[model samples]
Target: MGAKMLAEAMGMKALLYANWERLELAEVPEPQPKTGEVLIRVGHVGICGSELECVVQRHPRRKPPLIMGHEFAGTVVALGEGVANLSVGQKVAVNPFVVCHTCRWCRLGKSNICERRQLMSMHRPGAFAEFVAVPAENCHPLPDHADTRLGAMVEPVANAVHAVRLTGQVLPKRVVVFGAGPIGLVCAQVAKAMGAGFVVVVEIAPERLAVARQFADAVINPAETDFLTEVQALTDGEGFDLALDAVGRSQTRRMAVDAVHPTGVAVWVGLHDDETSLSGMGIVYGEKRVQGSYAYTDDDFAMALQLVVGGRVEVASWVQEFPLDEGVEVFWQLARGEARHIVKALLRP
Candidate 1:
């Protein structure tokens, strides 16, 4: 059925990106599922850091008059034609990246980099609303006993899994994570779950650092201490086997490369900044490998869900929840950095 046909039947509240640097709780016609799609009734949706950056900076790709949410958990309220695998009332965590299966990257099992990829918030209406339509294949079913909020966390955890998996390290002895944001914290936990001997987290925010201490073997505040010296001391001057930078600044990027031992790997996952200058000779002489990680593949997503469901990673304690009606205030508070205590925020619709 067409959306226009359903316009009079349903009206739902959504946090709309009505304009640049503005969010409004507006009632709009709920979306209708198309062929091969499923209409979900949103349960919990996370406010991604990237969404805050896009809204505050007015990113070109994420144009306004859009509903911007991707990390979400919901129930299958209705199924479109040709979608027979899912049924009404089934709980699920969604993979928001819609890719063209015929692309070369997709064929190589790297659909995260597909040439023609469409993201939920950027390319179409997202789960910030009461209802969203997504491809049936994008939904990963959750266990009957699982908390719906945990389903909302699967996306960010998948990001950490993808970043750590990209390093190709088997049971790294020591790992260092820059930034104690949601991604970095999860990376530390994932490294430990994958058998890293020790994990260190570096963050300037004291609130975030305090939370980091819960998961990391050691937490460092660069503003109050010598970061490189402390890192070297922790590794007995040998440096870490792997370093992951969840902060995309030039300094953190360089530090990630420097914090790893010779021939070690450095993975960059954050997107705070675009351009950075590094010492070419240093990377060459050290033989250090640097890789960039984007979103997760299907396998990574499934693995992440397993890790979360199996209780290998922590989620509930660090996440804060608010009503969907308060999304505007919550978004602005997060954008202004007022809610340091909240590692993650979810809007309950």
Candidate 2:
């Protein structure tokens, strides 16, 4: 305890987003848990695809000179005043969205879209350091059998959980997911977990498609063949019961709109493109439903944790772990698409 306390008094190593395309590895003062917050000793922090936008100064909410990690898991080191549920040394995964409970959206049970939502990396310092402070209510206890590496995946899995839940009353029997990236793969898996009968993944990258084939019933490479023809052949021209756009490209969005059956649903989970054109009459005449899913609700987060802790979801196959000091180079590699073989990267502090 004395040594741990001494280490806390001394500065800890942290990777700081100093500027666009710039990250600095420096020793910074240790963070203390404020009221209703818990100080966690970070075990692992996964890099998000959206963080690339933050690094390039494109994300609207995230600014520079920040600690940019949100998908993370750790052990509770200290509990702040007024926090009683968590204890020291309890392993937990974090839900990074800190919302204002007073907002109308929050009051309506849609806190994921809270008007005053403050994400950990975007609004406050995050877990790219040895320690991070988060609201005690955001922590979910992981089972003893669960690895912290897999625990770090709970957040992204929760994203998929929320996206699939947005389909509204229709549980997809035949589903097509556009893109085989991290989110896309997880979306397919969660759809299967949620009882989708058939799931197909579409991707241009052979490596990613091969990985997606592990979880999906089928995989299609759109670069070599016609995706629409293949999808039509699979469903006998009925179109998919559900279509999800996990790659936020104009082409993928269009594919989603075209692939879903009449009166079916299309969910847009990716945010790559801000503006896309869809046929107005096509939507009206076909009675197709399109919805956008952002982050996850508290119940979704809890269910995600349960999935990981219960060994129902597996992420160890596609994740690559690196030291926290190597985050800058890893971030650049991910941004440049150099690490195409791996699905996601984790920074271990």
Candidate 3:
């Protein structure tokens, strides 16, 4: 039978991004795998902050009338032809970013920046439904001892892994991360895990700062304290060895650079605004390295899976679970900033 016929027989429901600020829950054809692909019965899908930007029409490349969930975990239900390694019923996580292996960037071993890369929800349908089909290579099997729900966390944590990895060798003795959201918190935890002597998190939200306190060496609220002064006090005026800005705003981006020592490294991981300004003279004089860390590399992805599977990182502390049917409401709530304490959200279809 065809895909539409199979979906009708199975009765699948999907949430589609119909238009800006508009999402519709509809019964759609269950996706069937083609050659070298596999069908996954989605167990959990993470709602990314970038998706929230999509809803508000802030993301430059995101177009409407598509399925939007990318970070997800599921069980393999069926394998397409030529796919022999992944067995049905195996738990897995989706990498979401599919690259054309023939691209120059791919040939250079920088597939994360492949010129022809296609991402789920950006170039193809995604896992915001009861079922999703992806290339067999995109599925990473989760360990039998790991929590399947945590599979949804791999992509996000992988982002942090890539960011921290960009900072180079010699782990910082004191690290300062701006923003206490999901990415910020993960960056702090990853720094601590990598043996950073001290990890400090800066945020304006009290609720988020409260959660930041759970894993960071110090959580400072810029709303209540003089942020630069406090950071100086914490580092004894020498400045942090490494600074990460996960917020990506002008002010926080400036803070990420300013809070670091003369030769310290600063990495920007968030994708909020297109334009930001900094002092070129200061950058030249201070000899600071400011780098932009994009999506994770293949090795970073595998390491992220290990991080989650080993229970070294706790995601439940920040995620708020919701049924797939509530995806529309969840998007609106997050867009309006009403879901305060929910640093991350997962949709279980």
Residue-wise lDDT of candidate 1 within 1-349, one digit each (tens)?
6866656577899999999888999988878889999999999999999999999899999998999999999999989999999999999999999999999999999999999999999998898989999999999999998877999999999999999888775757999999999999899999998889899999999889989999999998999999889988999999988999999999999999999988988899999989988988888998999899998998899999999988899988899999999999999999999887788999998
Candidate 1 residue spans exceeding 4 A from truth? 1-8
Clashes of each: 0, 0, 0
lDDT per model vs. reference? 0.92, 0.88, 0.88
Q: What TM-score fits each model?
A: 0.97, 0.96, 0.96
Clashes of 3: 0
- Candidate 1 Cα RMSD (Å): 1.7
lDDT: which candidate is best? Answer: 1
Q: Could you tell me which residue pairs clash in candidate 2?
A: none
Better of 1 and 3 by TM-score: 1
The TM-score leader among the candidates is 1
Stretches > 4 Å off in candidate 2: 1-9, 57-60
Candidate 3 local lDDT, 1-349, one digit each (tens): 9966765577588988887778889887777789999999999999889888877874657787788888998999999999998999999988999999898889988889999899998898998999999999999999897655799999899999899988886688999999989899888988887779999999999888889999998988888888889988999889999998999898898888989989888899888877899988777899999999998877788888988888777787678889999988887899899989678989999
Q: Which is the winner by TM-score between candidate 1 and candidate 2?
A: 1
Q: Any idea what lDDT model 1 has?
A: 0.92
Worst 10 residues of 1 by lDDT: 1-10
